[model samples]
Target: MKIKKLIQALPAFVMLTSTGVLANNGYVNFPYPTVISATPSANTQTLSSTEYWEVVRGDELKTGVAISFTGNKSVVLLSPQYSHDMNGQKRAPAVAENAIELHTLQGKASLSATYNRDEMSGYGFAPGSAAVQANKLAGQNATLRLNQKISDDDLYLLHVKESDSPYQLNVESNVMVQEEAALVLHADVTGAKNIKPKLAIQVSAPDGQSIPYHFTNDKLAFDAPLEHVGAREGMYNVVVHSHSMVNGLEVKRSVRLPFVHQRESASVITYSLSEQTAKHVTANVSLNVSQEGRYGVVATLMGYRDGKQIALATSEAAQDFSTSETLPIRFTLPKGATGPYQVNILELKDQTRLQRFVQNELVTQ
Candidate 1:
């Protein structure tokens, strides 16, 4: 399929926002950045065949990874996959080294790390320092692997300070995410090549209830059913983190989203509007409500104007329900919006929020 068509065909769950996908449901599909390639100059060697991008705290990372080639090649700039959750757990793993290496350089060179800061205003890589000391890789054809590795939570922008020939680099990264739900939790992590990533997740409720769910490292991802009892009104949070060793480099990923706790008590069974009521610019949306709570209907009123079908307006009305009464919804009839209008129900749900139903529409008399 064509590229544009492919992107259009993606599910609504995918998005490129600060929290990966700006989703409110238990579903998520974060769109990885468009695989764009840079136009290389005649002197630029084939170190990167394609400019790869992935999400790190809503930022796109251009990665060439561990590809090796002859010639000076293009200087490979890297982005990160770092994770730091709430409760201030933002620190590097004891095993991580925030440093770079000049592995197998054929000519003279000076190499150092330049990494990115999360949510910075200017938005670019700054000079990075080893946790214990400042270090740089130098010398000709020498494999000077810095003893300090890059922090997993830090995005990288490594620079080949001065290099005359081809060189190899291996980098590490980290990312973070948080979410909330009461129904189901589903997640998928995809990156690297020929290596299976592992997931570890935790769910917590406002009342100090904690539940742990793990992704089965099978060919298919896993799903965990969530249920919070005592705290039904307060927010519930879920945190997920996944890790993998790609090309001998450690990669960590995380993201954040929201979902709501729902209850079922009402639904729009049918609706009605007479020529007389239509004259008053109103429609009676009939719903089968059980308990007393906010009940509503979301529909577009379709009318005709100038011999063409035109939407008068879309309306959403919610009110306290008692005795299963028909709720009257008001609409602003545009001038010359001649009816028989159609009440097209886009979503119909009972007091049980989110359990929506797709049904037919009603035509005004």
Candidate 2:
């Protein structure tokens, strides 16, 4: 983006009057200035001059003073400068800085700036443009402005307006869970009554599969059910699409909603290990099966040194558990010698069922 630059000779009688003043001796400068467009009814106010400068398309600006523009199509170009300190008998020229501060009381603006140092440094909104301290302005109206400190070689562009989008949509819930055999989603929208609104919902699973649903009504409020039996124990993306006719043309907007399905196993199991001795370690395991079933228990003893597994031992058994019944099982690691070892007890039903109990312990012998 090209920025409009304002450059002019400094009049000797010009004085600074704006609140944006550097601590030392500094002033703003305009170089290669150009006015793109402005309305005849627009006006500008400067600190040094009480008279407002009339808005024009090609008017040249004289100093780097703080100015406020009002009315339609009001625009100008400007930059800032600071005086250089003198050393011994030699006097150095003032250094030019690209730090600019802007505040909009009741308008919108778009700003773009190029930074010689870091590209991200030139794009912030603040109240003042000076390098030193500055004051902040307050107002209820929304304002679009840019505050940045740039080198004299960098360029920037700023455009301001006073308008808002004609339509807006807001969702009350971004995340929902499938509960009690059904998943329900809801949303609220505004500024869409006259446009004949339409709603569409799409669900995307983890395996790159998508299911789409379109609503029949144009109501701003929505409550819909998403039925999918295959969605289980993972995250799914629920996208809501809103379409409407604006000025006899169709406009569409979409938002991604978060949906999750979490189903836990029917049983719970816990285990603890006895203190290790020179010859073996013993683990005490407990299981509370909520559902009656035959469950398999596996205990694995593994030795680790320097964070890598060195040796392994396995023991397995099966038992029938009644509903709400507690079962206690014990396993012994028989490897005679060890430095650090881990014991893991896992209980499950066949290979297809989720693990009902998973417990581990670290011990030293």
lDDT (tens digit, per residue) of candidate 1 on 58-79: 1111121332322232233333
Candidate 1 Cα lDDT to native:
0.40
Q: Model 2 clash tally? A: 10
Compared with the true structure, all predictions reach lDDT values of 0.40, 0.36
Please report the TM-score between candidate 1 and the true structure. Answer: 0.45
Candidate 2 wrong stretches, greater than 4 Å? 1-166, 172-176, 194-196, 212-234, 247-249, 266-365
lDDT of 2 by residue, 1-365 (tens): 11122123223213311222222213221111221111122111111111111111101111132333222222222222222324323221221233333434433333334222231234332232222111222112222222333333322222221113334445444233423333444444355564544656666765556644443432122234433322343456655665555543333444555544333334435556665666545444455655554555455656654556644444444455555443232333334446465545433332123223333333222
lDDT of 2 at 254: 47
Q: Each prediction's TM-score against the native? A: 0.45, 0.27
On the 0 to 100 scale, the lDDT of residue 49 in model 1 is 15
Candidate 1 ranges with C-alpha deviation above 4 Å: 1-191, 212-232, 275-280, 347-365
Q: Which whole-number lDDT from 0 to 100 does residue 66 have in model 1?
A: 34
